[model samples]
Target: MAYVAAAAVLLGLLVVTNLILTVGVVRRLREHTAELAALRGGGSGGLDVDVAMPAGTPVGGFDATSVADLPVSLATLGERPLVGFFSPNCQPCKEKLPSFVEYAATRPQGRDAVLAVTIGTREETAALAELLGPVATVVVESDQGPVQRAFGVSGFPAFVLVEEGVVSASGFDLAPVVDRDAVALPAAG
Candidate 1:
């Protein structure tokens, strides 16, 4: 009878703990939703996760005045520069960085294969720039700045392939492209 009472007490404690945890999770979810709404600019409470720029868009003409002393010129976007737009506060962007770094590792690193464009202060983005510095040309711009807005980027973690100053292809997520490209290459025998 004592064992049974002890078991009942333990079960009650678990239930109370679970209730507290659930309430905390619910509160976090509400806060997250509110943040999304604010970021969405009061757009019916939905988050846009898609790249706003369409394929074949001319990027050479896009003014990058907000980003001073650009490393790569808008006049020459290089043979094929994969431009990745990211934000400091984005969780997905943080998660996507490893995949992007891996993808860049497969190519010739630094000032060639890719451009890491971040929307934040230099201090805020310094770590990210260094993280990608070995594998890409890092460019910093203000949030919703000219270069970003000109590229039609509404969110972080987007990619656009630029060849001869025009966007060849673009996507919101890099995983599919990274996976596909990794598989597409012929195996060295």
Candidate 2:
């Protein structure tokens, strides 16, 4: 009977130890998840704080010149310019570019209104420029340059709607830009 009692106590201790270890692991997993979200620019949920500047914020200091030498500026644009930031190394950016190019091609205003800034070498950005150049102006820069900063780009594949020298909407995805001025953006700040 004493042996039986000892065995039961040992089993209980083992169970308790397992429970404690499980809890610790779960807590560590939660911390890691939060850290990843921070690294992914606030996760896939929405635009991160670093890039969620509200609409109507004045945007300036971006050079209007492009490789094409076509003058482009938020203040000087005649229509609502959809600006996209992309990087050659970003998978999502590469995947998202086709849709963005299509959207720019089909914009209702029917002018070359879209603008894309890609960070890469001349060769790396050439294909991207070719895709967007027909319907948009393409600007190549080293690193995230002043134009991207003016537009609040915290990560690759960021986009914003600039109307009259100010940001009207921004998002990690294109849904917000699609719904822009028509509905609420999930990541709008």
Candidate 3:
């Protein structure tokens, strides 16, 4: 009977220890998740455009002057916003294109307001346009340097949302204001 009692006590201790460890693990996981969410701007209240342009980091191969010369800018696009930065040779860009297209369809003014800029030759641009179909305002620049510079794009598939000649929001997702003010339009049939 004494041995049984001792065995029960040992089992109880083991279970208690396991519970404590589980609790610790759960706490750590929660902390990690919170940190990740903060880094991703998940709980950062409203959107901020400056988040897209980290200070003191110049986007490579970009020439603001040259980009200014292009017909693609906030002023030219009118009140609608533009969202895109892509390279025809980028695999990830291709993979994300479908999602971008889907998101564009949900925009207030449809895909007309969304611009997909590709840094590639005319042929490559044509191919990318074909790939994206009628889902985006495809702009093919032989040299993405100016455009990249103008938008401060340091990487492939960078996105920016411009509102009334000013950058409103920029990040991975622009779904927040896709239906506000701008004329909403449906996806291509």
Who wins the lDDT comparison? 2
Sort the candidates on TM-score, descending order: 2, 1, 3
Per-model C-alpha RMSD: 9.7, 6.4, 8.9
| Residue lDDT tens for model 1, 1-189 | 999999999999999999999999999999897977554432324554556476668873554532336545565455566778888888878878887887776754235667778889999988788788777777888887766776788777787766566666666667544543344334311
lDDT of 2 by residue, 1-189 (tens): 999999999999999999999999999999878766654542454324545346778776566577788776675455477788888888777777888887777776544567788887779888887777787778888775777767767677787887666778876677677678334323332
TM-score, every prediction: 0.62, 0.70, 0.53
Model 3 gets an lDDT of 0.58
Worst 10 residues of 3 by lDDT: 59-68
On the 0 to 100 scale, the lDDT of residue 175 in model 3 is 46
Q: Over 4 Å off in model 3, which ranges?
A: 1-71, 172-189
lDDT of each candidate versus the true structure: 0.69, 0.73, 0.58
Native-referenced Cα lDDT, model 2: 0.73
